[model samples]
Target: MKIAPNSRVLITGGASGLGLALVLQFVERGARVLATDVHEEIPDSLRGLEGVSYLTLNVTQDVDWAKARDWVTETWDGLDYLFNNAGVAAGGRIELSEMDQWQWIVDINLLGVARGCRTFTPLMKEQGSGHIINTASAAGLIHPPRMTEYVAVKAGVVAISESLFHELKPYGVKVSVICPTFFKTNLTESLRGKDEQANKSAAKLIDKAKLSADTIAARVIRGIEKDRHIILTDRDGKVAYAAKRFARPLYYSMMKKASFQMAKKD
Candidate 1:
């Protein structure tokens, strides 16, 4: 959990956004890293790195995960950390969002993380020391309107991560889930929805975010060092979670008010 020198780390979705930020941060911290993505070509950010390597891994594909597992088991012989950070975005009311879109987001966002855990958990259990970091979202916690598909999958991620945290603890492995609010990232590049206004509003909030991926990644690194679980990686996220917990009636009122106002604008 210290991210010690030469720590063996593998990160998914490393081509861009928060995943890219995590890859760079790990490399800078003297960790020997494998940065994997669905893209065939390596990102320029990870090119020609000494301690960092790149591989093609589609988190939803069994073959890609098998390849990634083999790479870690053969080349590094062990893994210190596995980052299940690969995910896409989707937003719309339940009736508005297509079933195919729901399936796509579920496959990549929730089940993808589950697959990563299933693939590497035995390795980590055998090694007796490893950490799993999963990426959830504040939407997972807030359950805001107009994001049914996205919220459901992310909430599932949060659930699974908490389950894994307890399940892996007895095996000497650790699990942490990060629920970050909108930050400066390309996460919306994969956004899918039937509601154009919802999509645009989501993208606009992301554009207006003051927190950068680098800042969030840096905070996550610190949280990992301390073995902290359930990291809400921004001031807004932290405050919102606090408000939700301590002031439920007020929180629900605000959420309802915001939803109606947004709908009126649309």
Candidate 2:
């Protein structure tokens, strides 16, 4: 699906990070963007941007989605693209992770995307053309040890996006799953872990990664233009994806070594 001029786009978690970058990119490309986040105030950088508007939406809530949908329907008559990008991070050994943390991560990361898809699909179908982009992590394709809850939820997103791609194709709606590696984002602020030391170590590792949200968002726009299904952002993430697909043992070994290093750092 091409992001043409005047395209009506809605993005969740647009207050910061990749979501915000998407908003800016879409707006710059001449699309009408409605950026939503749970935050009461829109980010300062996005405040005065033309062709872009802000709405408060908690993707986890059905009511919030309904409100957002209603606003889009009323304002623009329909949506051309829906970005289900709101998510949180969690890390810990599966056995050691708390049940509440598991629930929180799943609800926001997996179910949040599900809710966005469910809420906006009908509208897109009615319009007869649209794209749905779900942000799954590279961890979804190559499971990293200790980030059990996050990996599980992201894996679920990847699976759902694949399924939806086939299911929605007949209706002229395209679904793309974004599997990106760690980049500088506010995701660390929401990271959950039982061990503070482990959390800090993980944050440090992510901070060292060179990719930025703007680069990822730019890639995402290109992927959308090309109608690509699996959008990967970084070299490491693309390599990990290929390794998992064509060389399973090597992928596992690489992931295991990385996990061991992180454990040692902690």
Candidate 3:
């Protein structure tokens, strides 16, 4: 999984946020980068950049994945890296979240990665060596109050990627799941704003945490080069993950206490 200069890479949701950051980093590293996003326009920073191409894509759709894969095969001949980074954040306790909201979040955050990995793996398998990076979240490891939809989907992503790691190992392909804490991104806007009350408090909580997209992208490149399976972006995320793994009951009890404290304050 060593990304030598001029290696071929494909990334989804690359118009902005961490996807855009990864695109810029790979392009600068001299990798032939193909990026896609639902956004019709390319970012000014990536426009006219050598060794980079942008396309419009909706990761949730099967047709979009097929089209992108075909385009990559035709244009690049093969892919060395595939970053399944498209995701959307939605907040609400499991009992309170709307069904449509859950479906939307899961479709993007979980199913999107699943579809990408399913379709793209065979293509990469042909090349005999490739890497797949799926963007998960710290909340996937340990859930907080609210954000149930996002947390559940991200958790599923981690599970899927972890499973794929073993499945693809025999093929000489690698899989990496990026579990990052709150990063400076527009993911907060993807929350269910139609239900303002449920999302307002969740937004405030997310705002208090600091995780920069630029920093996350740098770690992603390093992890891909090292062929690391799980890439925890924030040091805090690593610690939190360790705590959850060792003491699940204690970890959740502490969260419950914090939820009561926040409710009391409100």
- For all predicted structures, in order, the TM-scores are 0.97, 0.96, 0.93
Top model number, lDDT: 1
Q: What is the C-alpha lDDT profile of model 3 across 28-118, one tens digit per residue?
A: 8888998898877887757988888988789889998889988988998888888899888777556677788878888888999999999
Worst 10 residues of 1 by lDDT: 90-99
Candidate 2: worst 10 consecutive residues by lDDT?
A: 193-202
TM-score of 3: 0.93
lDDT of 2 by residue, 128-232 (tens): 888999999998888877778888999999999999999999999999999999898888899887867658867997798788899999999998888899998
Per residue, candidate 1 scores C-alpha lDDT tens digits across 1-266 of 46799999999998789998998898888989899998899878789877889999998899999999999999999999999999999997677898899899999999999999999999999989899999999888888888888889999999999999999899999999989999999978898888888889899999999999999999999999888989888888887888899999988988899889977886
Where is model 2 more than 4 Å wrong at Cα? 262-266
TM-score of 2: 0.96
Pick by TM-score: which candidate is best? 1
Candidate 1: segments with Cα more than 4 A from true spot = none
Poorest 10 consecutive residues by lDDT, candidate 3? 193-202
